[model samples]
Target: MNPTELLSLLALKKAPLVGDILAKKLIREFGSASAVFEQDKPSIAALEGMGDKKASFIENKTFLFKKAEKELEFIEKHRIKYRVYYNDDYSKRLQYCPDGPIIYFEKGKIELDNPYVLSIVGTRQITTNAAAFLEKFISEIAPLNPIIVSGYAYGVDILAHKLAIENKLQTVAVLAHGLNQTYPRNHEAYNEQMMENGGFISDFWHSDSFDRKNFLGRNRIIAGLSEATVVIESASKGGSLVTADLASDYNREVFAVPGRVNDKYSIGCNELIKQAKAHMLTKTEDIAYILGWEKKQDIAIQKQLFVELNDEEKQVFKYLKKADKELLDIIAMDLQMPVHKVASMLMGMELKGVVKPLPGKLFTLA
Candidate 1:
């Protein structure tokens, strides 16, 4: 955390092939990043995965340290804030990821302690349907006050941030480049507003090139920072799907909205669902239910009064009110609805606080 220790971390991060995983291992073994630099070549090479060749790169500490010092100057000059992986303020979910960045920089009033953090991503080329879905989804989920995480690219990513801001929720934008500059330039307009509530996060240095491959690293951060990652829409091959895979790899929940079979952007999401890689996201409740998010006790009673139910939900609500508590199957039969449809309605209603699920698959008016 001190200047010297931070310089060592920046230098270690700059070492070629001495990535986050290996850097963390060395830090753990030596007790600190500064200590790692004090070791002789033999001592460094003796560690697992470090051979003579890799040790040689680490031995050239002078060059690495000079680069790090320049970065340190940049940090100081710009007043950018950073977090080491082991720091208490670092993201807890991200800490669980083996390959998470050793240090990431930020610029804004960002808060990661919020209990509900979600990473929502999708195709850069957004579709009307996907946009509509995100708008409604964020609005419905706003009361829970989740921190929305997304890449600050065009289309779905930017839209998600805008919606989060509109809903008065904190939204963090994970950048592929550095905080020194915004990638698309056009998105610069949102920077001030974003920082006012949330802010930008990146592991890339100011000197790092804005290469296409950097997105893989950025996607991992997005995935690691949240309890769940939702793919709003994606083409057959895109970054959002990659984030979903990374989230799943981290043992975090992944939700993908199903789209029309023939739609181009829907292919990736559909494949994710078909392969059982992601949950089929139909309604907002699916996220709340799967994540086991409970409503605040103070608002539980009032939520029902304000929730607007559709005709189908109205029917389910009326039945639950009359029956008090009944089995899912009985409710489906009594309402002349398919069991699946009724179950779906129950999940949505449960989210709205209009209904509550009881033991043995029973449902009742809340």
Candidate 2:
């Protein structure tokens, strides 16, 4: 984009109450951010959801442009890279989100063209079990070469980035603050290594404040950038759950690792699975299967050669083989098994590469 248009977009983003959705709408209606700035008050107010007050705010661009100009200077001085929402280089998945930022800055060598981008999030106080699971999960899924995304915070987020680097996979850290500085101070150690392969991303400008509320905005970017979000562990309340909710709102697939009901960090994940908001993630294959990444031919080979199902799982396999696709309830009833028992068997069978889940609680042989 030209410097003139870029300045207008930055100023528009700084405008009070214009926000991402309305800013995008204004740009769409006016053909460009510069055009929106050139429009008269009457024309601006005439747009849907716009009023005299908002039009006035948008028209009063003097202060906004001053801030934008300062930010532009900072961008040039730091050699920071950025992506505009309408550009081809911006994240394709994030573009689908209505609230996605119109412009986001990046640092280091960041490439997001990978077909499979996965966001993994959890509590700051990650448990041993969750850590072990993430280590093994990243190693197993490394062969697929997905770009790993996470908040560059404590616990799960930082660990996810480290593991991705160790596995030689691209990993991007979505920050709550600006790319000019790292949060938590201690994590600055890994920044150099992370930027070598992955990098840092933030919508917050160099001048933006580092505040608690910024995390919500940061979480949206995390959720928006990926085809799926995985919650490895979370308490009943946390920022990771917020990311999961945003992912769901964007109509992206969500997965939660099942854990003992009484475990503190497992409560949120259990609730998500019980409420049917996310799939029950038992193993690495579950993600591949649910996202349709596992080819039928590949699964067929695994099923024929590697799978060794127990009696109950074998029963589910036989039933699904004949039924083609069957509901969970019907499978339990027809097989004279309890619903819970059948569900458990199906989960185990799915991990074994003999069964796959369909929409509306249906299952079929893989």
Candidate 3:
């Protein structure tokens, strides 16, 4: 069979060991996927990590081709969009990651070039506080137009996606299952709305199913795909703490919204901050500030927020507030007692929803 028919057939049959690792190994050792197809017995056997069990699995080109034909037939018949690694438009970032998908299936329009991309993750069973915190937290960050990426799973993942779309922001769902079907089944309508706004992506083909291991694979994609990762809530296991781990490994900023110490779901986030793997934050401002965007803050806003501030926070806010303020001057100046008294009042006012903590410590007359 020709190469076109051969690949399709392999895909349709759900050929054993045809996953990304095997495909990468084949390309690395043989120098080309087509070369592996024509390989002599020893050359094929010499492929690292490919023992006889895997070697024997691909001998059938015609039969597998027939099955692959059916799979492609299924996708086209059902209208699923497919993207192969060799394709020009494959995710530019994933192509470099060792753990990236073998193939990606995109169902609708997907745009990942947003100015800011964030991923907020956590456990399946979340807290009332975590849920409430996320609602308030997202509302504050919504106007910024962030492209949020998450697993589209039960807890924080779905919550992030739901809030992003509900607020009219672009939201992408990185999936664990194949594009041929949406897993957890309950998210069908939400999934549809996302495609219209943010869209979804999966590394597997139609033959792939949502296995136990696929979720971690999903997590890495989420981490690598986003500019920053925020862990709203997590347990000792599962959810987005693992994604935070991946984000750090990938050299991206990691953040966690702190929850009460006693909560199990929040334990991972707290541990991450304790270990310095992530920064602690309550709102998206923490991320924007760390990313060096505070430089662009309005000066009038900066003056009110920074001029009367005291101590370390004052210094930091002052440095951030003005275009030029020596750190030494900040260290030397004594804070005003009235400012402290005003600060306490302001904190209360802000918490009461009467005012906001604007950039540069500027508080409007809310």
Candidate 4:
């Protein structure tokens, strides 16, 4: 590893001493870390927050450059690439955050381009309606060629990626851990797919473990990198709302897709819309109108807005739009179309970008 790379590893791998707060103070006083490491015990003892015992211990602590050799070897063996905060390729958005990660690791290619990037965030416990609605949302915007970014968690984040993948759109996942590892083991498949299709990014250097503080900071980056944030569904207080609040503070558009007023999971989203902190999106047209994307999508399609037809399709659309429920019985009773015929019609609607069929025979309108 180069001297800078070696320095970064040494800095992060060391046990937390000074909270990030004290470390900044210490860094400014010492100038370069090398100069700090070279200081005599007595001189270190004179520094602020450095009582005789702490100064003597930390000043003399073995911060030998070789201590990072093993970590360097491990990452090299796995072919991982890393970067420092000042490096050109570092995430431009994250770099602006206060005390952003000192370094980062990358698993795939990504772009910091465009005047527009939007985050798709929500709760991990998602409903079929939420999933299907997100699918249509992505489809409408795919033609406009905007970048989609999200945290690589379950629920809304996964739905965003799944829809982005199906439409062959560019996406990225901002994680809270080192790129060398993932927090949720179950997202292994999703991670691989993202690396191949978009990218997985993080502020932690290799060997860094997941930390609660790290995730809160991670939300800041998600909010910073995008032009706006959309919360599909969230609890009263959770990571999604944190990102939305940050987006609002950053002077970016914040949109929310409201659910049934009584839904506990969607209460936060409803509140955001109600409080006028977020724009309510009944269709992708809401976002499109905000971005002036009519010039981008098919003019005819864009100009018409997303119309909810009031025919037989409307009856079916209304039912699915409300939520995804098993339809074999409902179709037979409500639509009065034969079960087989209704099934065929539903499939047609799915192809037409009007609905989505979830696992286990459930369906929702997209």
Q: Say which candidate scores most in TM-score.
A: 1
Per-candidate TM equals 0.83, 0.81, 0.72, 0.68
Model 1 superposed RMSD (Cα): 10.4
> CA lDDT of each candidate?
0.90, 0.88, 0.68, 0.71
Best by lDDT: 1
Q: lDDT tens digits, residues 255-289, model 2?
A: 99989989999999999999999999988889888
User: lDDT tens digits, residues 175-264, model 4?
Assistant: 887777776778887776787677877755566688877777678778877777999999888999999998887777899989888897
Which stretches of candidate 3 lie above 4 Å from their native place?
1-19, 28-31, 60-64, 293-366
TM-score between candidate 4 and the true structure: 0.68
Q: In model 1, where do residues sit more than 4 Å from their true spots?
A: 295-306, 309-366
Residue-level lDDT tens digits of model 3 in 315-356: 333333232322222323334335555566557544544345
Count of residue pairs whose backbone atoms collide, per candidate: 0, 0, 7, 0
Which is better, 2 or 4, measured by TM-score?
2
Give stretches of model 2 more than 4 Å off: 296-366
lDDT of 3: 0.68
